[model samples]
Every structure is written in structure tokens, then in C-alpha cells.
Target: MTQDTLNILHLGLGSFHRAHQAMYLNRLIEAGETGWQLAGGNLRPDMADTIAALERQHGEYTLETVTPAGERSYERIRSIRRIVPWDAELAGLIALGAEPSTRILSFTVTEAGYYLDERNELDLRYADLASDLAGTSRSTIYGALAVILAERRRRNAGPVTLLSCDNLRANGERFRHGFLAFLRQRGESELLHWVEANTTSPCSMVDRITPRPTPDVAERVKAATGWDDGAAVMGERFTQWVIEDRFCNGRPAWEEVGAEMVASVHPYEEAKIRILNASHSCIAWAGTLVGYRYIHEGALDPEIRRMAHDYVTDDVIPCLTPSPLDLSAYRDTVLDRFSNPHIRDTNQRVAADGFAKIPGFIAPTIRERLADGHGANSVALLPALFFAFLERWHRGELPFEYQDQGMDPDLAHGFFHAADPLLAFCQDLTLWGPLAGDRQLAHAIFGAYARVQHFLGRSPA
Candidate 1:
């Protein structure tokens, strides 16, 4: 064990980070590896209680894992050595990020947080991105990182790896594009040059069913481990992290701890996004419409499960043929993971980002199938389900609040008020991109929407 410790300044300190990436680092440490540590914080001021609790424990927390048969286990995760407290000015986060020892800067800001348009450019329509570009705010990931990188450059912190663990396809490349655009728009030409020469953003695909922590997580931890751990997190027993090996400075030997370090993460990411993520959302939206509270309930429901299975088998598998993975087996495993009753992943959590998911996770399959003159009937059902889910949200019929960061409330509400709500939804450029008003796309969606209506025991719109 060396005295010099390398640091990863993780941007988001949420449950996913605790259960997935930090857990991998903890595994390395547990296996007697040293000189690699994680310092975690968040750009947003949310998760106040969790942050405070972690601070009290000096960044230690418990992680509870459960299997399908309801077997549970707990481990004390001590990888996060520092919990930088939240501040309006982000002074603490910047300080840590600029440190010479912080060799890697990683983030899980969620899919919508990127704010990239269909053209893969940073969309200024988002006020947060605009504010960050105009130097008024640092709430967005690009903004927060801009100041941190500027400070790092000032102190000559040398090179660092900017790893994005988000669900975006080519996440590292997309983030680099947006980050460079943010710098360009902010007129930081010198800093942009420095960044181009000094940083590496490797695309990574992270999979784990880390649900939002409930009170029961802490209770279970106390019962099993005899600890009153307020900051404990829980996830399913399955976990995977696949990263492209393109670090500029240095990185942990993650591959030694069950993390897949690959030459290209494209195939892995595409499969996960189209198969697991899109299907997860499909189950969530369909389950919510049919009054299922948890993801496992929907995954176990024959009808909803078939909807996901058929989508992958019909639309996605064709697009992803000649790939490294066994698509059929992957699909079944994903469904089985979703069906783990012990995880208790919520409908609201998975179903929150319909607007974003449509474009990011589900649209490519529809676009590809249509281009090849193949039927997108199965994949179309996902958007149809989201449309029904959105209508419920519009009518205040949802069992819980629908949280969509990428949603424009005015535009979404206007859909229900339009003369033909379904057609209005079909023409959404943000959702469908170039295929927004395509007749074939609309026809498939309309047909699928009717099936959705029939499934819900309502007359077709």
C-alpha cells in the first residue's frame, strides 16, 4: 500500500453511485488494493439528509443487496473518503476537483442532465445550460466542471480522466462535445485547447438496480448488521460496469474487481440501452397505467413482460445482430433482474423520464426499423405506453408525482388540449427527431396507441 492516494472526485453522490461505482472501488480496497480513493459530492442541493448522514460517518455507509429468492446481505462501504458538503458557490467541490491527486472525475448526472439536442449539440433551450454558458450558474454538469477544470488548469493539475457513467449512448464522446461547446460558447478558447489536449472522457455502461432508498433500507440494515445507518443504499445482487480504456492520467485497476475494461463500449452500451433501459421504462409506464406500484410487479405481469420481450425480439435484436452479446439470453436475464421482487424498484423512479427516454433509449430502434422498412410495431408500444402515462399525469390521475427533467410542462400539457392528442404527441420534434412527423412512424404509433387503449379497457382514441 502506497502512501500517495489517487482520488476520484465523483460528481453525484446518489444511490446509484453508492451501489455501483463506489462499490467497485470498495471491492478493490477490500481486496488489499490501496492508494485509490473516492471523494463524492453533488452539483445539486438535493439529498441533504443523505449527505449529512454520510458526513457524520466520515463518508462511510452501508450497502444492502438482495436476490430474487429474497436472500439479503449487507456490507459497509468505505471507499468514499471525503463527502464535500453542498454550498451555493461550490467552493468545496471545486477545491477537490482541482487537486493534483484527483486523477479521475466521474459523474452520474442521469440521462436528461446532458441536455444534448438531436444533432448532438448542447441544447441551449434548457435554461440551466444557457445560464451556465452565460456564467450565471454552475448547477449543470458542464458548468460545474467548467469552473473545476479552469481551476485545475490554473494550478496545472496535469492530465485527468473525465469518466461519465451515465446512460447516454457514446456518453464520453457526447459529454466531451457538450463540454467543449460550453467552453466555446463561454469564449474560453485557451481553456478549450487545454482541455482538448489534457482530458479523456471514456464512455462507460453501468448496470445495477439501485432503487431510491426507502426507510425500510435502513431498517433492514439495522436488523441484519445492527447499525442505525441512515445513509444505507440497496440494490439487486446483479451489477456490471464496462468502460472504454482511455484514461489520460491514471485509473484504478477496475477490471480486477469484475469491471469490464474494454477497447470500445459501443456494442455493450447499445445493447443495454435498447434492451434493458428501454424495456425497464416500458414496464414502468405499462405497469403504472395498470396500477402497479413496483417494477417487479410489472416485470412479473405476463402481459407487461411480453410487451418488453416482444419489443426486444422483434425490433431491437434485428438492429443489433452480429454483436458480441447473445441478445436473447441478455433480454431474458434483464427481465429476470427486473422481476426480482426483493429489489422493489419503483414505477415512478423508472417512469419519470419519458420525454428523455423516448429519444435516448427507445427512438433509435423505431428509426432503424422504419429505415429498413421493417415494422416497428413492438417498439412503438413503448411510446404509446408513455403517451398513456403522460395523459394520466396530465389529468392528475397518476398515483404519484411524475418527475421529468427533460419535460416542458407547457408543451406536454398542450398535447392533451390539442385537437388530436395522439397526433400532437407523434409530431413532437424533441421526442421523435427527424421522424417526428413521418407518416409511417405516426401510423405505427397510432396503431400501438390503440392497442394500449384496448389493454387499459378504454376505447381507442
Candidate 2:
């Protein structure tokens, strides 16, 4: 561990970061790069145990990549230099952010972290933001970043680039909104202005299927290395990151390490949100309804596989900007990636956090289809299935576990129950934005919801 290595701090230590960003940094290191090393902070107390285990192993872990060729495991991933528990070490977390060596602040805190209002500005109503404004020790990654940026401004230090690896569209913009809202609320107008003028939050599109490793995979890694490591991550062989060329401080030669740096990440982000994410939600909701447990099993089923493919190719892809890449090739790759048996991604895991995922991933596409004067025949079917799934999931009738992150269960129930004709649910502008006001589109979606519900029918509990 050399001091000269560039210090990059990652906020969330989830499976996605381990498989995606950490692996990318490792690739750079293996290629003889010296300017990049990673440090991590786990935001929650329960995460401290995992952080401790990774530190005990010298911040080293194995990555098992599953592809059609075979399952290959890489044993030595040395890019991660340290893991700091955020709750136990708040001062250390703030200090790491103020360090001049730290140029990039990356996060995978998921959509919930943004905490936006109806206008999509940072939600001041959030309890954590309220606490941060009161000059309390900020706990969430966004809150911590706000405090760090305020400190960095006082020191006249150089600006830092913030990167959001979450699934939300224009995720960088959302993060900026949340961070700026916190700064402004704290009466730090000058600091807020400085960040607006100096910092860059580049939009990006990232795709990879990294399932939380099964106990068996963890055991295998330990048996292979004669070391007990619990933080190992297993993922599908496929991975892609397309980022807009925007940064305040200098960035890693990520392009040199197979990341695509583009003039605008909009097209790539839109494509992924529509084609990949939308299809994933469809499979997740519908597969669970049909009693399939794993993503690979759902992909294997003749009916479910066709529905997933058609939902993407026939409906979603057409709504996206035309790309030079072969659409069929992309679709084939997505299917193959989902079918990787070595990754046991549960339908339930994919279905988690529907409130955040749907509006960004599926509903936006639905709006696009409607705006283009396309009927809801195919596109509307997805949310219909989703709404149905929500109804069942809330009632505790579905076998899959639902993770709501404090979103009101009654509100979810109301959204499904009140949309009696099913298409009426599309009329809830609060849920679908302004597009929900379009009567023709709303009616079409309602019809589709009705059709799916009719098909499912009332079975014995």
C-alpha cells in the first residue's frame, strides 16, 4: 500500500460495489497503474461486522464470474486498501473526505438515499436531512458528503467529483439535488454556490447481475484459500459502464480499463433503463407470480422467456434512441447473462424497492411509448403485472419477500385496490408523473391490468 496511490472513497460496501467498481479498480492495478487505491465506509451498524471481516482478510476477496464458457474465480483483488465503519468512526469518515488525496466520492446507497420530493428536488422532509440541517453528525453517505464538501470549501481544497452507481436515471443529477438541498437548508449558501460552480456529477449507465453470494460459494472461496472470507461476491460475466465525460477533479483512466466515456450518457442510460432494467422487473414480478424462484429458472421457462424478450425487443427497444450496436445481439447477451446458472439471483431480490425502481425503470418507458402515440398494448402490460404483484405482495399472499424501506404498506395497497378497473391506476399522476393524465394511455394500461388480473384469478390461498 503506497501513499502515492490515489485515494478513492466508496460509501456503500454492498455486493454490487464489490463485483463492479472494485473489480474495475483491480483491473487498473493489474495493468501496472499506481495512482488508484480504494477505501470503503459502511453506513450502517450491522454492516460493521462485514467490514471487520474484510479488514481481517487485509481488504482482499475473491470474485467469481460465471459465463457460458465456465465459472472462473479471481483470488487476489487488492485495490481495496481499508474499510472504515461509518457509525463507529464518524470523525475518520469526515477526515477521509477532507483528505486531498481523495478525489472521487462514489456511492451505491441505492435510490432511497436520494430522498427527493414530488418535484424531484431533495426532500427536506426526510428525517436524516432534518438532523443534518441541525448541525448533528450526519450519518447517511449523502449527509456525510454534504458535511465534507462544506469542510473542503473552508480549507480552500480542490473540488471532488461525485459518482452515483445507483439504477436511477440521471442519478448524478438526483444526488446533486439531494446534496445541494442539504447545504442550502443548513444556511451554507456560499458552500452550496461553490459546489454548484465547482463540482461535477456525471451521468452513467452501469449493468451487471451480481447476486449476493450463496453460503456454498463463500465456503468454496474459504476452502480454496484456507482463509475464512465472508465478503466474497459472485456475479455474471457481463459488465458494462458508460459515463458522460464530466468531472471536476481528474478521473481515473477508466476508459483505458474498458469503461466507455461518451459525450452524453443519455442514450446509454435510457437503453439500459428501458431494455435491461424494465425486463428485469417484468421477470421479477411475473416470475414470482408463476412460482419461479431463481432468475435462471424464469429465463428457462418457455412462456416467461418469450414474454421477457418481447417486452424488451418489441416494446421497449423501439422507444429508445437508435444505436449503432446490434439490438438483437444486445438482447441475446441480456438473455444469456440472466441464464447464468451459477448466479442464483432470486426474483424477490430483483423485485425489492419497487417504489423507486418502477418510476425510473418501467414507468418512464411507458410514458415514452404513450407520448409517441404508441398504444399501451405491450408496454402497459408491465406495470399492470407490477401493480398486481404489489397487491399480492402487500397482502402477504406472494411467496417472495418484499422490501419496502418504510414506504407505507397501506399506500401501496391503496394504489392497487383503488385502481379497481386496473386502468384507473394509470390515472394517478402522483405515481406516474404527468403522463398518468393522458386518458387514452391510462385506459389502455387499465385494460392491460385488468387482463393480467383476470388471468391470475382468485385462487385458493
lDDT of 1 at 432: 84
lDDT of 2 by residue, 171-198 (tens): 8887887788777777888988989986
Error of 2 at 53 (Å): 0.7
Q: Clashes in model 2: which pairs?
A: 6-35, 423-446
| Worst lDDT 10-window in candidate 2 | 421-430
Clashes of 1: 0
Superposed by TM-score, candidate 2 places the C-alpha of residue 9 at a distance from the truth, in angstroms, of: 0.8
Top candidate when judged by lDDT against the true structure: 1
TM-score of each: 0.98, 0.92
